[model samples]
Target: MPSGRPSGRVPTAEEGKKPGARSIPPGLAPRPRAVPDYVVKYPAIRSPRQREGYKGVFQDQLAEYTELLGEVRTAQRRLRETEAAMGRLPRHATSRTRVSRGRDSAFLEKQQRCEYLKKKLTHIKARIQEYDRDARDSAVYF
Candidate 1:
């Protein structure tokens, strides 16, 4: 046989026991800190551009430069392939020969395109240099 009884009871102050009170010491206990009026009155200051320093124009236009350089390389490769094909044509294939004429035209067109790509690349490099010079001479952020 067994007896049933309530196992829980409220602790009393006489026993130097508090069931729910925080155990932190009085001096070290957390308290609300009152901030100064000036600190609370002013709004936070922030810059528009996170990266304000003058990291040259080259960095800013890096993607464009890379894309143009890739175009130039592709044009050069195409020009080389066209030249090689023209060279492989038989010596007997003269100006009157359709195959010879076609190869010659292709070679000329590819050469012109390669030249244009080279000029465009030079223009892009000049623009980047100008930007760099401007960045060096002037303060971008106020």
Candidate 2:
């Protein structure tokens, strides 16, 4: 009788080697580095026309940013005016003295304007980010 239990097959020479003798483990191998498909297929200068278009779009975005900055400045001025008007109200000891409706309305209006301006600024900032993304994407080439 055989000393070892009989199996259907015997191990191959490579599999019979010591663990350290194997160049790579059964489950592990160096992965092949991947190259971007676009870079592999196309030259860097393939789209000059598209690059020009992106530059034009970027310039337009710069102009829009300037306009938004101006609007922000105007909003700041309006806010300052409202604050100054609020400051002018008398701080008197008379309990019976009522604040004027006109002043209160003005103050509310100014607050609303400031809020609107802040929202507008946020919108403009989002637009700027979109423009930047577009510019970046357009600049990328194979």
Candidate 3:
């Protein structure tokens, strides 16, 4: 035993937690407390137009937004595939050591496709970002 220390088997972090500690994390909402009877009797009115944390995108407009998000994801996947295909395209050199017609044409086509996809992706992402921000505008308050 050391000075000002207890002589016992010490607990490790994985084994157990000390007293007055929470095992699991709490959510963003304030902890529940015993509300005074008077306050409860005269509780304020809160208009719940939507559910808390509407990650589900429950609104009608949000349904379209969700679909658009899915499309964006699909487009991103296509873009990656296109870029990969571009990389895998074969390069044939002529006797003068110049990149041949077949490779050049294939590479240009792939490059153009990639550029178009990139621009489209950027536009869609911007729109989705604005929609996300709009969702955060309205709120429920105390």
Deviation in Å, model 3, residue 11 alpha carbon = 99
Q: Write the per-residue lDDT of candidate 3 for residues 65-94, one digit (tens) a residue.
A: 456556555655765776566567665422
User: Residues 34-90, candidate 1, lDDT per residue (tens digit)?
Assistant: 764323432222232312222233354455556655665676687577667777877
- Once fitted onto the true fold, the runs of candidate 3 whose alpha carbons sit more than 4 angstroms away are 1-97, 101-103, 140-142
Output the better candidate (1/2) by lDDT: 2
Clashes of 1: 0
Separately for all candidates shown, the number of backbone clashes (residues 3 or more apart, or on different chains) is 0, 0, 0
Clash-forming residue pairs, model 2: none
Candidate 3 Cα deviation (angstroms), residue 58:
20
lDDT of each: 0.52, 0.55, 0.48
Per-residue error for 24 in candidate 1, Å, reads: 96
- Predicted structure 1: lDDT: 0.52
Candidate 1: residue 125 lDDT (0-100): 53
10 residues in a row with least lDDT, candidate 3:
45-54
